[model samples]
Target chain A: MRRNRVLAAVAAGLLLTGALTACSATGEGGPVTVKLLQFQEARADVVKDLIPEFEKAMAKKGRPVKVDLVTDILTDDQFRTKITQQFYSGTAPDVVDMGGSNVTGMAGAGYLLKLDTYLRTWDGWDEYYPSVKKGARQRDGSYYSVPHEASVQSLFYRKDVLQRLGIDTAQPRTWNELIARLKKVRAKTGEAPLVIPAGTAWGGGSWTEGLLPIVAGTGSTLYDEKSGKWKLRSKGLSATFDLYADLVEADLLPVRDLHNPNPWEPTKYEKFPQGTLPVAAQGSWGWKYDWGPEGAAPIKNSREKIGTWDYPALVPGTEPAPISGGGFGYSVNADAAHPDAAVELAKWLSSGKALARQLTAVGAVSPRAGLADTAPYSNEPSLLQAEGKLKSSIQPPLGDGEDRVSQAVQSATAKILAGEADGSQAADAFAEEAEQLLGSTRVAE
Target chain B: MTTVKNPAARPTRRRRERAALPLLLGPSVLLIAVFVIAPAAYGVYLGLTNTQLTGFAARDPQFVGLENFRNLLGSADFLESLGRTGEFVLWSAIIGQTVLGMLAALLLRQKWLRGKGLFGALMLLPMVVPEVVASLTWASVLSSESDGTFNRLLGLFGSGAAAPLQEYPMASVILINVWRGIAFAMIMFQAALEDVPDELIEASRMDGASALQVFRHITLPLIRGPVFLYLLLTTITTVGVFGLVYFLTQGGPGQDTEITSIYIFQSAFKYSQIGLGSAASVILLILLTILGMTYARLAKVEV
Candidate 1:
């Protein structure tokens, strides 16, 4: 009886230990794994450098989160497929980066967590601009994303080339002055004076960003909020189209020869940095990535020679026009295991201090309002110029009709450039398409 | 001996054997049903609906019923891609595999060739190279820049710049596919040739027939079945060519070399139009099915 009792006790102890181990393995307070997906390949290295810092910070807070960064070098569509598959399998990443248009569709699918409750109490929420906050919120006025960075479209000119043509580098405040300078530069250089990439989809969108500010400066809304429709046929838009056509017809802009499959390659950053192209219309981020310390060293001492200026108004007396605010942000997955941890990480990443550090490293504008003016980047002359210009920058209309309007503008510009359609025809076609896309109620005057 | 089993007992034994047979084959049958048939059926179902990946939870997918098919029919891009895929199948599988394979088989049959076994193995080097490696190698060889092997060779011949793919996108990819595929075709044909009866060829030669005449009359007829088999196999393989096109041009320089498989991939993954992409895939499948049936009937007669 004594020997049997001892044996029974040993068996019970083993069983208890096995049960305890199993229970402990699946319990809370254990390291929770999170996956992060991003688009930019260059940002992979930056994330790698920052993950240890994040982990260390979390350790101090007694939160044990193990983030598994899965850097996918895929196109926008490919990333969507992966995200969709994960959702189907019930194994989606805790956080993801999505384009502005994609967020609505994803949120509608219930794949994103509503962050309204968190946003209301978050201490650092006030750092973001009102426009940024408004843009990041869903239709129900619930916030879902944290804005990381913002970009503005600007004219990147080769100072040496402009100086060679006896054009002033001190900012041209009006469209007529800019055009006069472009003609002089063309006459002296015998090269395409203004570079625009029409073949690339993103490149095609550049026209809308470049022209929106000019139209807005002329006191015309690109899209009327009351009507919820785009105004391609408006007098302001027609003038913008005419100016674009005139530029192309006069050989001021190379639209015909520049219609190569990869138009952005020969004229933009690739050639601009190598001194093959004189001027390019590009985003502020492109300026940083293509010209900053992390980028290819500018043509020996060309850093001082390179200059940036805002899009000038159509007329002299119009509001100083600029296209503002285009960039990516982070949002937590609705099905994430650790929602709190994900939100914490997102908020930390979007904080003014963190954004400032990122800007110092990458030379991009922070989404936070005052960071551009007060951060370490404020001292840089070109950035300071961009900051000064940001006040006049006009935000692109946000709604279902935005993409259609933008595409119409691009297609119309392409037609005018190709000489298949004149400015008037292009403008008329654009108006019809925009009206059809935006519905009659939203049509701008 | 005189006593015989009852009919009911015999039938019961037969029934037991039938049940056991299923038990024996159950695992394999279940695997095929789960992995192959189920997914294929699911794909067909998905092809009929207008399902967007992002809006899956809130939005009920409308049964668009043939809208995807109609869209594909109207799309110039889709038609162009199908034509490109057909051209690829012709050049790569028909001309490259069949003709080159026959030539290799004939060469290997020569008694003058030393180390026949070793030579036979050497011929399969291209087949053994990984697809990714092969694609990268071909890409480097056909690179548009001066650094590429083909351009460098052209330079040696007194040319400045030569872009084979850019100039002839379809032909360039076909050439790469053919070069990579010839080894398998050669091996299959060589095996088929070895199986041809030596006596028949000897008899034809003895009747004062020339070497070419004997080969034409006897060897060709004898090898027809295998040749037909090879053609069918190669066609199926070539029709689904994606990796080469993807690593090479990505269906561009203005969609000059886009194929059906590449189109399906773009629609499904890149464009996020899963339903439309699935429909495109079904179209490709129907095309391949027709070809397969035709080949099967032709192969039966040839054999």
Candidate 2:
């Protein structure tokens, strides 16, 4: 009986130990495990290849951390939902890959670890473009995330199609000139010459991908940083809407295609390659991820066939600047057990060959200054060209009330696309809605 | 007389039994309280607050009692979605699925019908297909491309790319949902019809009653229990349908097909207005409850 009791006790103790071990993320005497969560399929393979290298580098830096990365792919939508829930539930991943838009809100909600102290000591901090570093800074002058790759918005046009139509391939000096060019294309071919993603279906794209570059080129900011107010109605905003109205009224834009569930499919993938759409405002990703040999719809000799142009100014006197935003960036969760290691890993992912490989795979320009002279970045001419556009690029201040502003843009542009409202009317309605959401004090005309 | 010596013992035993009642029912009551009641209560609380999925409001939400609901009621989009949801449920669930399923079931019950097993299998195919797969199949069929299944069929008659989804989003969604939901109703009605006595129909037929009269007077009344049950189930399920409409048209083409559920999803996940979405959900819950109660009362079914 004594022997049997002892055996039962031993079994029970062993079972309890196993349960506790299973529950713990890092076991006793085991290396601290840092979890990395991400959702970019274009960079998934590259990221996976870089993880072992990251682990080795960290070991050399005196942190013997075991990186726990889940290879299960998630769509962007899934990532947003999962990350939000995880943060609220206090089970957030140690390090995360997210869009630039999410940084401000996440930082404000206290979900992200403030990275200013770490960044100050890091050598690569000076290598990142000034615009990128400034965009990542919160209103409180704290950094919460580091931009991994930069997606500069540019005018993606078909070179062969433009040449055939006898249209100048040079960048138009102003919005009016660009509009005239679009009209010429439509008059010659009778096909919608441009696609600027609009409608509520396009979601945030209506703001960032479609409107921001034009707004920036107009020399008026949507959300003024100095006044800390959303420019609900301004000359620049009206000009942006007027341009949209012109495209819609003249039938120079694919209005129907913009309302499709996935507008990018019909506009960028199918129509552009088929020559039905000649010009579109797209991120630098259009070079490879949207039109490359390995893209969903590859155009033969895409690099040779496609050309890039900066968004033009509203008036001739001012120089035009393209828009740039963080394509994908890394952040350390505030609740991480291995925050130091996580921060190191994030820094490792942002600079050197790792960032180059990731950016090249996704057709994005590196925010880091010298990466353009390196092997992988130099091999790709698209990246080299896009690098030059980065310095002249403007990243609109996005943090507080960004979601509401995006919605307002989508709602206004959607009305423009449907022909329900003209530019002035839509601007009025947009102003009203933004004022209601952000309050009168926070909105400006 | 025989139990007179221990009469107090019987009362004690009865008291013990009464005390043990809670112990026996504790697990079930606790489960329901945790799973159903707690979440619902939290939803109600969340509805009264200005809780957002992101930004400062996410961490420290302020109470804005009835504001979310007031905004929802005032918004044209929400009101339109309610109307569209009503039309969708009426056409797809109440009328389309019920009638077609009954017809299919009646035909399969016919002795003269050949290949009854094959026909039933074919009808069951949509039900067996995964929701996402079925949605993809329908998407392909109704694609705007000239080579799409429906477009190709239209092309045979010299029609251009109809783009039926963009032109007729509600009708297309209703049609697809009707197709997907028919099998469940058919199965239910088939089982109910099996319990329906053939002798009564034969008697009625001999008494100069036509097939239609017999069905109207006998079969329908006999299967009234299952009919109401199916209606209650189908109505609730149809109102909650998300994947079919979402994957196909995501409440698009300018909110033409934005049903109540889709609106709630957009308000919550898309717009990140958790409070507004929760308020909408609370209203939806109350409406569904009233609907279920009305159905139960009309059917005179036991609770």
State which candidate has the highest DockQ: 2
> Looking at model 1 chain B, which ten-residue stretch has the lowest summed lDDT?
B51-60
Query: A166 in model 1: Cα distance from truth in Å?
Result: 6.1
| Candidate 2 per-residue lDDT over residues A38-120, each given as its tens digit | 67666777788899998888777667778888654765545665677778789888999888877766776789999989999
lDDT of 1 by residue, A1-445 (tens): 9999999999999999998898777656676676777765655556656667777788788987777787877554356557767765677778876555456556656778898888889877876766566556655456667767666667778888677767788777876788888888777777667875442233324344455545655666665555444556667777777777777877887653344334554566456775546677766766556677565343545457677777766744564455664566777898887898888777776765566665555555666666655555665555555555555566665543344455456556666665766768878867865554333555655
User: Each candidate's lDDT (Cα)?
Assistant: 0.69, 0.84
Which residue pairs does candidate 1 place in steric collision? A227-A441, A227-A442, A228-A442, A229-A442
DockQ of 2: 0.47
Check candidate 2 and list the clashing pairs.
none
Best by TM-score: 2
Clashes of 2: 0
- TM-scores of the candidates are 0.80, 0.90
For every prediction, compared with the true complex, DockQ reads 0.24, 0.47
